[model samples]
Target: MALVNTKEMFKKAYEGGYAIGAFNVNNMEIIQGITEAAGELKAPVILQVSKGARAYANPTYLVKLVEAAVAQNPDIPITLHLDHGPSYEMCKACIDDGFTSVMFDGSSKPFEENVAEAAKVVEYAHKYNVTVEAELGTLGGVEDEVSVEADKAMYTDPEQVQDFVNQTGVDSLAIAIGTSHGAYKFKPGQDPKLRLDILEEVSKRLPGFPIVLHGASSVPQEFVNIINQYGGNMPNAIGIPESELRKAAKMAVCKINVDSDIRLAMTASIRKYFAEHPDHFDPRQYLAPARQAVKDMVAHKITEVMGCDGKA
Candidate 1:
């Protein structure tokens, strides 16, 4: 009924061998679409807000939008999470602003510094019963304000996972295993692959600990084709394969962050709608189907990819 943290969701997912879909939300329609799907599927979901999202849609507006979603879907468990909170201050602000969970992404920093900063966030967040998530590896590509060059992207060092988890006391840990941040995850001719071997080693070290995958969105080719068919020119835009993500879900991955696929779905729908109705001027005309597109995409994820359907 109320906003719950990822603690219970991750626990159940770990035991059930499925992963919860963590959808990034920017507005009322997106929230409606994601939560509506969750309600129908009987799945626990996470609604995450990134730094850019807060900047675009005012933090208070996003929080109230999630509150409205909670009111609408009282039967489904939901978590309002701050994604990639870059600093202790940001994490503190989200915890103070009633976020059920917050991520302190200090992966780019030195290992010791990351642990120390994450520990500070965990200490502060736990005071308010808020759960904390931390990142260990630098992911390639860009999402919101976070970016890493492909050459610089690094897989999480399995050797340091135990030490980092022990030091930070984070509720969940996001590790990079070839999944990048944005839509252009792989080149046109390149084979997209995830380093599942690294994940296996991490699991061996941190048994039963909740693991998370950022940039897990499978850029649905149908959406890409629709967008390209209309007016968009996103060339060779690809993403992590759903098969790989599903495999990770059954592993130690308890949470999978999906952002770009939702964007693509909504954008493709709006583009196609306008292409068909050039005379339309109302935002609702296009946004309605865009909302439905989000719902459809999320449903596929819940039932097909994450396998979290009926796990609420």
Candidate 2:
């Protein structure tokens, strides 16, 4: 009926051995596609807004789009989340603007600084009943304003998780265990692997804690092929295997953030549509199919990858 925080969702996910899909939202079609699938399947979903998205779509428009989704899907629990908020000001703004959850990503900063900044955000967000998510290690690849070289990426140290959580008092912890951002996550002929061992250690150290995974999209080759087939140039864009993500869900991962897959699905669909109908100049004509493709992809993720189809 209204925007809900991730607290109860993550709690149920941890106990049920499933993960909730946190889909990125920028415009009306993306939000419509995500919430349509979620409402139809009765899955609780998180609609996250990145800093870049906020700038591109205008924060006010994004909020109105999310509120529209709330009105349209009264039976499903949906969350308006700030994804990868770069500073306390951004987090505070989102929390005050009606975001149910916010993520303060200080992974690139010094550990002590990260803890301090995240604690500051947590202290303020709690007063409004908003949940905070903080990151531990850096992830590689480009996504919006977040990027790190592969050489600079670090696996989350399980040893530091407890102290960081205790100091920051965060509701969720995002640890970089090997998943990278964007489409070109892996190179050709290389098997994508996740450091599940690190994840296991972190989960053991903080039992019953909710773990968040960023850049967890399982880039469907079918979408890549469709894009490539229609003149797109995304090559060797591999993602974490769904099997691996499912395993992590069974472990301790409660929230899995998926962005690139949504991009690929819509891009591939629009590309194929444009190629097929070169005469169509109507935006609605092409966007309808693109929106449907997004719906299909998200529905698949809800039922297959996220395992949260009926948990709403």
Candidate 3:
């Protein structure tokens, strides 16, 4: 099958009470790892690229890498998405570059400006049969170029969701329900709880509308432990609990963004490989295990957390 837009995938996920994993990708190994896992599980997936990824890998290389993954896994559906697209031009560029979906994250802009920008992108994207995702509230923490301080982060107001969706004509909406970016999502003493009430209210407002959750990676403790045990010093890193993420997936959320988990998994595996094989200098010697670690992490998320396994 050809690369698909997220419209059909999100529709099925929403109806089936499962969410598709939107894993961030920057290179060939990450793309292979994520798509291979999804293909084996017969699960649909969203391979997302951030601005940072585009800058690091170049847009052409990233797009071709995703194309290669699609060729390798023709049985499974894959959507190439732009995560947290900072501007209308960026979103349009992705749409023109063959991305099936693009997110215009105008969360930092004023309400009216955000609506205008998102509406503009949606109009252009729809002309090419591409899907657009828009965000209503800001998420705290840093991912790529997106960074919001904890105090500045705000929850999506349920009252505004209907208007936002109606005005922007977005195919999906990403609402802030207390999940933040990066691994250190919460302070050590703070309670890491998602405001499911907000999600419920948003669902009621926009019935059957596909919803998205950003910064939803449940930083698996095993990967963290491995990184630390292998001589890394990441202290007090925390993430949203898998149980809570499962609850969201069962609700209105149709897509969940997870990037940090893959990073941790790859980092941990490479660190461990280096510790054990000190004499091995070839890049593949370490990167091979790192790739497998990504595959395992993605598989676990598909089967255990997102509950989208076999949904393709």
Candidate 4:
């Protein structure tokens, strides 16, 4: 159909032991790639726009591009979401502009202020039947305008989950359970393990409430190698393992955020294309393959990691 909020989608995903893939969109190719993959797999998808994305590609352009994608794939469910919304005004602006869902990312603020601002946005968004996702704990690493230090990152306190939910009335809760933002989530030698114990505790406190995982991209080694081989120097770009993400999908987690993987795939494809076809000067000639690479990555995530394929 058209763009929809994550309320029903998350409910079904939670009951069915799957998580909806929330892919970030920065341009027309990225939007096309994500929706094409989701439509082909018959999976529900969320196309999220970050503040940086809105600045790079104007909000109207992004909205219309998503609308065009929906028109192209009428059978698949797609939602336009505001990722890491920093303030109530930002969330409100997106809602008024027809975003189906919005996240009030107040994780870096004081807990009381976070809750208060989230509550205010929730109050306004609910009136329009839009879904609101609120972050409880700060996730480390940087993505666009959102940034946090590793030392400052904290796993969401399971004890405060119920109170936060009760106070904010948010549809979903994004928790930092050891997953950092950006492609370099962990070092080369370090382990990448999600805090499932914290997830379990949160689930126990608010059973069936939709849980969200940010910075969940499993950076494919293939893309990393391709980029490096094609004259890029991205050293030790590690991400959460696919097995760990699959486990989270089987738990209370109903939404998984992925951005860096798509970027890596697209960049690697373009770099390889340019290296091989040095004569090609047209943007579409190379961007087409890059878009296809993104589609492939997202399809893999939906089928293998999130377990959301054919769940539309």
Give the alpha-carbon lDDT of every model. 0.93, 0.94, 0.93, 0.94
Candidate 1 per-residue lDDT over residues 1-312, each given as its tens digit: 999998989999999999999999999899999999999999999999999999999999999999999998998899999999999999999988899999999999999999999999999999999999999999989899998999999999999999999988999999999899988888777778889999999999999999999988877778889999997888776788889999999999999999999999999999999999999999998999999999999999999999999998
- The clash tally of candidate 3 reads 0
Candidate 1: worst 10 consecutive residues by lDDT?
Answer: 231-240
Tens-digit lDDT track of model 4 for 70-137: 99999988999999999999999999999999999999888899999999999999999999999988
For model 2 the TM-score comes to 0.98
TM-score of each: 0.99, 0.98, 0.98, 0.99
Worst 10 residues of 3 by lDDT: 183-192
Please state the error at residue 279 of candidate 3 in Å.
1.1
Expressed as tens digits, the lDDT of each residue in 8-113 for candidate 2 is: 9999999999999999998999999999999999999999999999999999999999999999999988999999999999999998789999999999999999
Off by over 4 Å in 3: none
For all candidates, the clash counts are: 0, 0, 0, 0
Residue 189's lDDT within candidate 4 is 83
* Pairs of residues at least 3 apart in sequence or in different chains that clash in candidate 3: none
Kindly give the stretch of ten consecutive residues in candidate 2 with the minimal lDDT sum: 232-241
